[model samples]
Target chain A: MGEVIVITSGKGGVGKTTSTANIGTGMAMMGKKVALIDTDIGLRNLDVVMGLENRIVYNLVDVVENNCRIKQALIKDKRYPNLYLLPSAQTKDKTAVTPEQMKKLTSELRNEFDYILLDCPAGIEQGFKNAIAGADRALVVTTPEVSAVRDADRIIGLLEANDINKTHLIVNRLRADMVKEGNMMSSDDVVEILAIDLIGIVPDDEHIVISANNGEPLAGSDCQAGQAYMNISKRILGENVPYLDLEVTKTFFQRFASIFKR
Target chain B: MGFLSNWFKSSESSSDIAKSRLKLAITSDRAVCSPELMEQMKNDIIKVISKYVDIDTKGLDIKVTRTELDDESGTVNAVLASIPIKDKRPFRG
Candidate 1:
């Protein structure tokens, strides 16, 4: 059966949708059949982020309401044959879909896909509840800000309270230069405060913004953030890929030399 | 004089301040005590202790906080309270 993982953050604008898109694409690039579900019903943006918004004829509510079959609502990404997206409904609110419906949908999806990723909405409300109902694991994304870290701690507590114990932390948007100058909190500091296992860290990169603007995810791109997402995907597939060193920007020669050491 | 004072002062980095503040905030968030429950608990404690001694009720301070264990194994959520006694009650035998 496929693993259903939910990417969630209690606060908005902390890279939950972006991480879901990249990780699902990264897994698909490794030849795994992946499905990305956007659970933010009223404020759906994963379709746009994945560049599949134009092809979304049917959405999550349509499938849940039995107005269309699951296959009809699933939008296949052209770049990756193995990747697909289940876009959210912009007209309907969070109350339109219940947790029981989400559970049934994800259980049905597990039979066909190798990995099912749920992009959760912000806050600890019904939207968050529906996204995590069928999830076997959770990835909590947070930046190096006080508000994000505080919300992350609350998310971890809520996850444990709900018995979703296999949760991991993803520290995103880390600035290594700021960390070196002691102006920003490092991933180590975040992990220590959150007291959870670190899966991966993505540094702040302009490429991420550019990819989002162009409606393309950073999969197989020669960027540090892209490499970090691919590393996270390999780790999810039970591969022991060491984390990319973001302490300093390495030259092409140095990176090439490190490949030989591996 | 401003430059000399600035050089003499030990400046704390903003990241360090953020870390310490976050740690403090999380510690309280994990303690999980409602304001009403805390107030009821304080009143209960004060009522029971008032029979033994005269305490300054307004001076009572109580809060749920995290602290390290004596054996240093790990930290735990502890209810720390400080109450002042104005006078001792007469012994009734």
Candidate 2:
């Protein structure tokens, strides 16, 4: 059976869609049958982020509304095998789907896939609720900003309230320079505040924007952010992978001295 | 010398301020109890404990936190009260 994991952040533009795309693609590369479902309803973007928008004929609403079979609604990825995407209905709003309907669809999906990642919409509204309804676990993504961390804390509380106790934290877009200057929070700081298991920390990289616009997530790429996402996927697969040294971009002397200190 | 000073300043990062503020905020947010309620409870605790010995109420810190239960089933919301002392002697009866 598969586990349905919801990627949510109460604040918008916190990289929930990007994380969903990259992590799902990484998991599929490990030979695990993975599926990414965009539950953002009218504000669908995961299909485009994964560069599969042109192929989406039927969407989540079609599957739940009986317009098509679940298999018919699934769009196979062109790049990665054992990976699929279930696009959201761009015409209808979040109210078009309910938590109960999501539960039904994911329950059916569990039998076929190893991991089903739900790309949740922002806020604590109906869209967020519907995305998490079928989820057994949650990955709360947040940037190091105070506002994003505050909202992520609230989302974690809400997930636990709904009996989804197995929640993890993904601190996204961390800038080492800002953190060194005391202008940004470190990943350790976020973990201490949110009090959840640390799953991954994706650095703030320009490649993310470039890849997203080109309809590709940073999966399997050799960039720093791509490597982090790959590490997170391995952790999800029960492999205890240590985090990469994000502070590796230091001056040559600093990097050399650190080896002796350790 | 200016560059060296800048590097030292980063060690005392403003993250300390954020950590303290967030800790207080999340304690209130847990809804185990409100901040006002926790203040009242802390006062009452000091009053009760003070009958036995002198306490430094100003230094007392009481907050609601989550603690894992021994049974490993789930967590339980708990109140942690740390009261500093001013003197060791008991109050006169």
Candidate 3:
């Protein structure tokens, strides 16, 4: 059976949708059948982020509403044969789908795909509850900013309260240079504060924005952020991939440590 | 003047400040009582304790913080009560 994982953040614009797309694509490339579900309903942007917006003839609401089959609502990604997207309806609000329906839907999906990733909406509302209702694991995405980290902490508390015992963290859009200068928080800082297992740390890359705008996920590529997502996918697949050297711009400890290894 | 001002300024960067602040915030969130509630409890404890003994109110520190009681529920907030005495009383062993 496929594991159901939800990507969430307490605050908006922390790259939950982007991380969902890239991780889904990376897993598919690794020969795992993956389905990306956009659960944001009214503010659906996962389709746009995945560059599958133009092909959405049906959406999540259609599947839940029984207007269309789940297979029909799923949009296959051209880049990766195993990767598919279940887009959310633009016209319907979050109330269009209920937590019970989501639970049932994900259970059905668990039988078909190796990974069922839910792109959760920001904030701890009905949308968040529905997204996590059927999830066995959670990945809380956050930036290096105080607000993002604070929201991530809040989400971790909520996830623990809900009995989602398996929770990991993804720190995205990390600028190494700023971290070195002490202008921004480091991955260590975030992980230390959140006290959750660190799944991946993605660097700040211009290609991420470019790929999002162009409807392409940069996974399985040389893009730093994309490579980070790929590494996270491998880790999720039970691979012991060592973390990337994304300790912000400062390599003081790393450099100091490497000197001894050499 | 420059040396004194530099000495007064802490070496903690903004990121350090953020980590410390977030740690405090999350601890409070997990705590059962709010800041005001903790404050009231502290005052009440002080009032009751001062009925028999002279204590240093300014030096006294009490907070509703985490306690290492149960390993599993270590995050559960608990009260830390400490009161300093102003004078010592003679005792016979």
Candidate 4:
């Protein structure tokens, strides 16, 4: 059976959708049969982010209502053959699906795929509850800002209250230069505040926005954030992959000089 | 006028900026203390404590500190408030 992991955050615009697409793609690239589900319902954007909006005929509602089979609603990724997406129903609200329904759907999907990634909606509402129903673990994504950390802390408390203990942190939109200048919080600071195990730190790369717009995850290319996502996917698969050192920035000559000095 | 000016200058002593706003907010959130009620309680505390002891009214500090009561349990927490009293006794030779 495949593991079900939900990518969630309490605050909006923290790149939960982007992380979902990238991490799903990363896991697929590792030869895992992965299915990404958008649980945002009315605010569905994972289909557009994954660049499969045009291909989505049936959605999660259709599958749950038995209007279409689960396999029929699954959209295979063009870039990675192993990756698939279950788009959310834009016309329906979060109340259209219950947590029990989500659990049933995921349990069935778990038997067929190696990984089922649920892209959760922002806020600790009904949508959030349904998103985490059948998940074996959770990935709480947040930025280095105080507000994001505050929301992330609240989400962690809620998750713990719900008895979801297997949760990890992913600090996204990190700006190393701002952190170095003491203008923004560092990954270490965020981890300390949130009090969770760090899984990944995606840098504030403009390429990510552009790539998402183009329906191509930066993780498919040689971007730093992309590399971080790949590393996160490996770690999720129980690999002892070391975290990328994002604090240090070195030019080619500086790297060579450091190598010689060492 | 000069004495009043000196008094005012002395009253404006530099102190460390309060860096515990977030901590205070978190404590109050956990404790379910409304901001208005918290202010009133602080004033009442100052009024009650002043009757017995002299406090540095400007330097008066009343903050809620949370500590884990135990390691085995997850919901273990305690809130404590610290209020320092000024030394009012005259120096003895």
Give the best candidate by DockQ: 1
Q: What is the TM-score of chain A alone in each candidate?
A: 0.94, 0.94, 0.93, 0.94
lDDT for B71 in candidate 3 is: 62
* lDDT assessment of candidate 4: 0.83
lDDT of 2 by residue, A18-119 (tens): 999999999998899999999999989999999999998999999999999999999999888799999999999779999999999999999999999999
| Residue pairs with backbone atoms closer than 3 Å in model 2 (clashes) | none
Question: Model 2: how far is B82 from its true place, Å?
Answer: 3.7
**Candidate 3's residue-wise lDDT over A73-170, tens digit each?**
99999788888999999998888999999999999999999999999999999999999999999999999888899889889878877889799999
Q: For residues B23-54, could you state the per-residue lDDT of candidate 2 as single tens digits?
A: 77766777577668877888889889988888
Candidate 4 lDDT over A68-158, as tens digits, reads 9999999999899999999999998789999999999999999889999999999999999999989989999999776677788778777
For residues B1-93, could you state the per-residue lDDT of candidate 4 as single tens digits?
544565565332221111134334445555545668768888998899887777778876565433434673454334355766686572332
TM-score for model 3? 0.85
What DockQ values do the models have? 0.35, 0.34, 0.34, 0.07
Off by over 4 Å in 3: A247-262, B1-10, B44-77, B80-93
Estimated TM-score per prediction? 0.83, 0.86, 0.85, 0.78
Give model 2's clash tally.
Answer: 0
The TM-score obtained for chain B of candidate 1 when compared with the true chain B = 0.65
Ranking by DockQ: 1, 3, 2, 4
Q: In each prediction, how many residue pairs overlap at the backbone (N, C-alpha, C within less than 3 A)?
A: 0, 0, 4, 0
- Higher-scoring candidate on DockQ, 1 or 2: 1
